[model samples]
Target: MEKKIITISRQFGSGGHEVGMKLAQKLGVKFYDKELVDMLAKDGKYNADFIEANEEKCSPPMCPVMPGFSMPVFYQDLPSDLIYKGQSKLIRTLAERGPCVVVGRCADYILRNMNPVNCFVYGSLEARVNRKMSMIPEGLSFTREEIKKRVIDVDKKRAKYHEFYTDKRWGRMEDYDLCVNTDKVGIEGAVETIAAYVEHCK
Candidate 1:
């Protein structure tokens, strides 16, 4: 049997990560998300904080965060470019190893040659805001307005990162094999739908 890979690109507060995790579990495959960042940090001998901060983010032309000052000496070079290259390499390496569900980091584009099932998950603003609010800690105070702003900001950053790296429009339906609106079908339904597709593909 041929290996199958699922790459998910999600909007903030879209519950895409939850769906991806559930799908991977149901499919009995490995899942990659923040785990990829940790792996890169450990393998590259980079500060985890530095990798997290710059991962999926394009570098400013002016080098806003100077190494040995704002950043560690290990990150003195072109850190953003290195981060992109490192993660891209890791994504391809993992895909070659076996089947896995990779969330974001342009995994869809990175594994394009592998004919992976690329999914884009998005939700209505109202649904996204509610989802974000529900995830906040009980004692934490976050208004709906604040959550909405956060969602927009995060989506914008993701779009910019995708465009910068792949030159493809983020969340665009044409770029994906499946485009799901979690607001309509809910997370569990979305997972079931994608899982069925995966099974059929096999």
Candidate 2:
């Protein structure tokens, strides 16, 4: 049987990671999300936090500013173009390795030629807010207002990044083979549905 690769693009609180992990387990293939970030961190010799901040941020082109605000200067150490290039290269390298489930970092667009089984996960705002609240780590005091703002901000950034890189609208059905709503089917159901889809593609 030929193996298939699945790429899931999702809203922040849509339980996409849970579904992807379950789907990867069922398909007996590797799952990548945070691990991909860690791999890039190791390979590029940069901290994971730095990679996370710079990963999907389509920053405006500008020379580095000095501490004293004396003048804007270009830094050879941090090339502006490297941010996108490095992340895109890492995503491609991972896909080239084998059949795997990759979440976020625009894997869908990066692997466009590979014909990956692409999916986009979304959910109702209420459902997403509730999920975000429940999933908040202990000691974190995030109100619904905060969660709502965060979700909107992240999705906006994702959309901007997608458009900047691929010139395609984000969260569009035409961009993916499957679109799953976690609110309708729940996390496990979404996983089963994707597993079925992956099997069908084989």
RMSD per model, one decimal: 5.1, 4.3
| Global lDDT scores for all candidate models | 0.87, 0.83
Displacement of the residue 83 alpha carbon in candidate 1, Å: 1.3
In candidate 1, the residue pairs with backbone N, CA or C atoms under 3 Å apart (3 or more residues apart, or in different chains) clash, namely none
**Each candidate's clash count:** 0, 0
Cα deviation at 199, candidate 1, in Å, is 2.2
User: Residue by residue across 140-179, what tens digits does model 2's lDDT show?
Assistant: 8988899999988988988888787786788998988999
Best by lDDT: 1
TM-score, one value per model: 0.89, 0.87
Clashes of 1: 0
What would the TM-score be for candidate 1 when compared with the true structure? 0.89
Report the C-alpha displacement of residue 178, candidate 2, in angstroms: 0.4
Which candidate has the highest TM-score of all? 1
